[model samples]
Target: MVDRLEQSKALASDVRLTILTWLKTPALHFPHQVTGDPAEIGVCVTLLADTLRISQPTVSRHLEVLRRAGFLRVRRIGRWSFFARDEITLSDYAEWLRDTL
Candidate 1:
């Protein structure tokens, strides 16, 4: 489990939050993928980079933050990496926040 401080740091950025929000409904936020289903394969890093208008490496860094926070689930296909939100973790985090507050 990630410590509260690290989790807080991970979520403290607007980019990370937006990435999380976009993952909630990837089909709506991302264009149709040629090889894989968004729901099954998760959103591609290329799509995220295009959507954010940032370099792929930058998007990767943001994704790393969320991953470390336990907010994302990842799948690697060949050279590509796909990401999806870990809803269960988010739910637990939400509950923790509610109880803490």
Candidate 2:
């Protein structure tokens, strides 16, 4: 779909890919992560901010863009909203990108 291409374009940046990579290895990139269960519980924006050395608001903005473009998903637990890559959508998108391009 055209929308998928647009979303792919949005994610073409290396920073976005780095973000995904960090999410894939939360414990390595981010300290204070529990010994187990970052993937299930998702990641906090503050941890992302500290790890990536980016401003909190800037990280939030990138996350918002990723969410809007369908590469990321959010889960709200009580007051905090955690984030993770949307593997289903991302997998399909990868296949689509390969097929299309």
Cα RMSD (angstroms) for every candidate in the order listed: 1.0, 2.3
Q: Which ten residues in a row have the lowest lDDT in candidate 2?
A: 28-37
**Runs of candidate 1 exceeding 4 Å displacement:** none
Candidate 2 C-alpha lDDT tens digits along 1-101? 43875686668777777888888766666657653356777888777887788998988888888888888898877777678888887888889879978
Q: Count clashing residue pairs in model 1.
A: 0
- TM-score of every model versus the real structure: 0.94, 0.84
Whole-model lDDT values for every prediction = 0.89, 0.78
> Relative to the unseen true structure, what is the C-alpha lDDT of residue 25 in candidate 1, on a scale of 0 to 100?
90
lDDT of 1 by residue, 1-101 (tens): 54777878889999999999989998888757765888788999999999999999999999998998899989999999999999998998888889999
TM-score of 1: 0.94
Error in Å for residue 18 of model 1: 0.7
